[model samples]
Target: MHQTETSDDQNSRQAAKPPLRIIISRGSDASSFTVRPLMAALAAGTCMLVIGGYLAAAGYMMLREDNSDTSRLTQAAQTRFYEERIAKLRARVDEVTSRSLVAEQRYEKQIAALKKRQGEINARHSRVADVLARAAESGLTIAASDPLPVAKPRPALAFDATLAESTEATGGAMVPIDASVDMLGLRGSMGGVAKKADRRTPASPEKATISSEPTGASAGLRADSVIMSRIDSALDVMNRQSETALDLIAVAAERRIARIERVTSSLGLNLNVDGDGVGGPFVPLTSVSFDARLARAEKAVAKLSSLRDGVKSLPFGSPLEGAHDYSSTYGPRLDPFLRSPAMHTGLDFRAPIGTPVHATAAGTVVSAGRKGGYGLMVEIDHGDGVSTRFGHLSRIVATVGDRVDIGEVVGLVGNTGRSTGAHLHYETRLPSGTVDPELFLNAGEKLSGIL
Candidate 1:
């Protein structure tokens, strides 16, 4: 029975022991642990490492994409800014260029106007010079109380040194235009010339005032205005002078005409007569200007010249050609035949019988025959209602309608009817009545120098 109990206890102890476990090691003497625990720890470490690597790779990709997008946006902004800047610069250049062109055009126009004015001034100066030359030749004297001072010549315009050098370096392309010059000095010189001219001429009321202020775009234009003003003033002075000269000439002509008319009045000759009828277009008379007054004065002078020539041909000289003694004067004297106070109607010149009697002036014989009182007579009809009669003539040499020149033999002196002795009777008759022959002879002597 003891043996059976011991076997049963051994069998129970063997059944309660643990199961077998496996281990692995790298070296032969190294301590080792269970394979299952090692495998479980390795598996957990590998899973954690794999998860960290995946997170790092995703973050790198996001950063690379963000950098590329920002670079593209920056490049686009820079390009737009440059393009706008270029547009503004181009617009500014165009505006500057347009202004330069307009300024150039205006400068050219001012230059042209100045040139035209200069030409006009030159023309007027030449005319004035010619007039002065004529006056000198005619011995006309001009008296001036105060003489004008001579003006110095203006110097040429000088450009800036910097501008000149730049122009030369750039072949004249980059030259700067200088509008300022000595135009005011040039105007002063012209004014001096005008003042000199005025001093030489007579005083006149038509004077112009000159402005010294600068005008127009250039110095040349301003000078031109000043010169033009001087020229206008000179023209006005010349006009006035011409008018005065014409008036003086007309007055002189009128005096001559008056003298001639006075002598013709006694012969019933009307020299101061106008036209009987008006013909052609009837133009209304207006106020005469300088030119018209001059023309009329010239006409008057010509008419007076013609009248003077006519007066020279009239019978105003002595009737007898040779030396002879006057017995009876041409007034109330005692007649030799009646021996009483009687009127002597003609001049009695003592001469030999059959003495040649010559005509005193140019005329045509109207009667050359015997009259009621005079045995033989020779009557000559001068122009302008004047007549000469040689009464008591011995013989008549000129026939009726015969043209006789001055100092030509027209009859013979002799004692004929109504005469007492051998003498010549010369009678000067006018349209109104008889006149003394001595009066005409005295007038002829006085007018010898003028006529």
Candidate 2:
């Protein structure tokens, strides 16, 4: 027993000590559990770690929501900036397109044609422009934007229908037209641009913006491929419209001139279209082919001038100022005095006594006195072999050789000539002899509004 007392025995006694015991109590029951100090501390530390983790997660979620709002606001501002930039670019493109609109008349074409016919196009455009200028000078001002001048063209059909559709397709906000472009001046610059266009190869839309243009062109008026294509199309439409207008005007003028010629022939008169006074320096025609359209236009212009010069000289005025009612017509009629078939050489106008007679046209008084049958008469010789005679006058105021103008008072009405009562005998004497006075008066009525 004395030999069992060793150091190892004491260390094993400390290590074998039991854990603490605790008792749990409730209303009618109770329980007991044992726990070590290290285990209690470890359980408390686990609960704290879970609570701290949950709080950290909540703060992170709130921060994320705030960041999302800031992100949305930043994105919206950038979108608006881009939208404004896009609008400005569109405005600039439209403005560039308006440059060609300054030219008058109209035409249209496809983008495919842009690659071909550069030199020919330049010359053709000049001629097309002249069509408008000439038409305007002839009193048919063809507006650049106007459709075909024909009344039926407003509805559109076939070619016109295509133009109408294209017009609608190209419609956009148009710039106001105030200034005019000098087309002749633009030729050189346009040719250079055309060369540049030809030298370049086709590229994608994104890279097809104009690189450079002639300095003589409108300042800073450049465009992308889309805008350039549209401009080309508009110019073509204008040219076509001009040609259509020229055709209509030329045809109409020619027909009117033809009718005028027939009327003059019936009167036994010649109308010299190229007047007596015309002299100018002769310049040869341009290198461009003499356009048949231009030739037609020139002819039309000549005819218009003829109407102004020749027709104005014709006796297209009334002999009686306000009253031209005829009691007896020219040609064979029953004689009012003899009651026999007689050849009437003049028109007898119904009028009261002492009515003032006016000269039918501008002329010199050749005879202004009484004759055998015509008691108190007057005869005036209008130029170009045209003469007028007024008989059966009460009193004659114009003497022989008196230069008289149209509508000037020459005499008074009365029963002076081979007396049938108070009336006027008017005769229009042509080279073949006295023709119908009514014919000239009727023609005058027809042309009163026009010439």
Candidate 3:
């Protein structure tokens, strides 16, 4: 009974799923081939595996493409953020640049003003230097040192005492100053100071250009500050140099004028230039500027020059050449012809018969002819109400209306007229009357170097 049940179960199972079979036949050969169920199943399993693998590969590729797109979008957003940040920074930079430009402009203006002032100061100093050079050329020279003439000390005013103290601190004591000497070494010291100032001073505008550039705003500001400081120092130095040079010129001119006045006064000469040609209301100097002071100094020098010119034309030279012996002195003496005590109006210089008699000063011949007591006489009319006469001459070489200079031979000495010997009778006359010739000769001797 168990065997029949087993066989029946097997038969039923086979009927439910019969074996997969396929047959092929060749008619002529009568041969056949069949595919079994197991082979068919194996083939199906292999096909399913290939299809699943293909599907899995496709899905993975799609996921990878999506991730790539997300990455691209994220990169774009980050780039936009960076671009906005850059724009904001650029705006801030522009603002800072504008502020820096304003500051730089201010500094440039200051530099321009300083340069102008420096130029002006340099011009002033140059003018003062020119004046000093002119003064030296005109014989108004001041030595580095000279003998200071003793003088009564001037009573110092309150202001003068204070000034003296200040001056003493600089280099010298408060004593009388010498006109020809550069007292207190003020001139040399001021020149030294000026030289030092020039060395320390900044360059001119052409040499030193204003710049406000740097790696950053801070650096530019610092550079500007340094430039400003340098310019300030340059300005200070230029101003001081100009002032010192002006002062030196003024002081030197005034002192020279004072010396000239003293010499002329001592010689009893009133050669002061007359200002009657120009008339104006008297105005005292209270607020005199540098230019005014310089003008006054110039005027003083001009006065000195006028006095020198007058002195040169004075009758101060001898009428005879070289050394000469006086035959008779001027004033009351025995007359040459009468031999009686009489007033002699002129000096008699004893010389050889042909000795040359020269003109004492430059003048025009007024007369050259024989007179009652002064035969072969020559009279010269020097300007300024002065005249000279040469008497007892051998020959009158100078004609009337002839202009003669000092030391020019006007005649020869001889025993003519009322003279007892070969001699020249010389007389000097002023507007007042005939005066002694010795007065001018002595004055000339005293001022030999001055003229």
Candidate 4:
């Protein structure tokens, strides 16, 4: 029973264990073995070999796939880097080109402005030259000055040499536009001519001498600056001439005022008094320079005008329009009616009956009625205490308070009052006393040409 139990136990153990087998053949002689240890070893070895072969094949396929993916990623990264670099380079080139174009346009505008200014300067120089020539022709001497030294022409500004060379190296074409040379040359020539002209100009009329000094830094100055200097000099000379002319005019006006004042003073009239005849707003002398001279001249001219107006109101013309014989003279004369030596206050003109009698000056009639020894007499007040009387009229044509101008008919010549026949009597009176009518008449005759 124990043996049976042990064998059953062994069989049970054997059933639980796995089976192994091995076979060997050599040249058709076959042999078989069934050792559990050897079969187990052989089966384990075969399984190991089969697993190793499968793992090696899988590893080789994985390695090849990894290599292909890595190569694609590297190529993509390299392409992206090259593209970014090329884009940046193109942007830089465009920026440089735009800036260069802007700079070129700015330079062109500057050149145009400079050319316009040069033209204006040339025109002004021509005008100054013409004026000098005219002065020389009018007997004004001009001395020649030393010529200005010519300067070496400067090289014009050029385009960027480096940029041009780069373009050529890159096999690119470029066209350069250069105008600064011509413009600068023109400006230099104009400056030279102007300098020569300035040297020839006389310094003063009195000296009539010109300096022959060579131009220095001033010749190198801009055209506009040189023109300004010439203009300033011309203005100064014009101002001096204006001052001289004003002085002459003032002197002449003073002489004329003096003469008028003297004549009015003899008639007991003060011209300085602000009478109804002459008065206006007073302008005071406030300036101390050229303006003061102008003010004085204006005042003098105004005074002269006032004096002339006053003189016009005085009796200084023939009462009759036509020529007539004088029947009597002013001052000590024989009275025709009285037939005696008496003081004759007026002059008598003989005319046909009913002949027109006129006024010798402009005035308002004060009295126009019959008076003692004077019939149909007309008296006129010619302002500033001056008056005139006309008498012995056949008919009174003018009434009292009537304004009459010089040479206007006032009455008719007739034998009336103390007059012997058809005649007219005239008298000139001032505030002080009566004056001789012949004096004014003679003065008027002398001044007729000027008037």
RMSD of 3: 19.5
The candidates, ranked best first by TM-score, are 3, 2, 4, 1
Report the C-alpha displacement of residue 269, candidate 2, in angstroms.
Answer: 4.3
lDDT of 3 by residue, 220-333 (tens): 688878978987887786665545444555555555445555655664556666443446776544355657756755665566567656765777777864444354545553
| Candidate 4 error regions (>4 Å) | 1-226, 274-288, 322-325, 353-355, 445-451
Per-model TM values vs. the true structure:
0.41, 0.46, 0.50, 0.45
Quantify all predictions' global Cα lDDT against the true fold: 0.57, 0.60, 0.62, 0.59
Writing each residue's lDDT as its tens digit, candidate 1 over 1-451 gives 9999999999898777543355566667555454454566787778777877777777777877788778777877887788788878888888767765775676566556556655654554454344333332322212223243234233342322332211111000011222332321221110111110000111221111111065545555456556656755665555445444455445555565666677666545565543233257643333556456556555556556666556656666566643444555565433344333344556666566777888877899999998756668898998777888887788999999999987789999776766655667788878777787766665554443334
Identify the leading candidate in terms of lDDT. Answer: 3
Q: In terms of TM-score, which candidate is stronger, 1 or 2? A: 2
Candidate number with the higher lDDT (1 or 3): 3
Tell me how many clashing residue pairs each candidate has: 0, 12, 0, 2
Q: Kindly report the root-mean-square deviation of model 2 from the true structure over all alpha carbons.
A: 29.7
Clashing pairs in 1: none
Report the backbone clash tally of model 4: 2
Query: If both were scored by TM-score, which would come out higher, candidate 1 or candidate 4?
Result: 4
Segments of candidate 1 deviating more than 4 angstroms: 1-249, 266-269, 275-289, 309-314, 321-325, 350-356, 372-375, 383-385, 393-395, 412-422, 431-433, 449-451
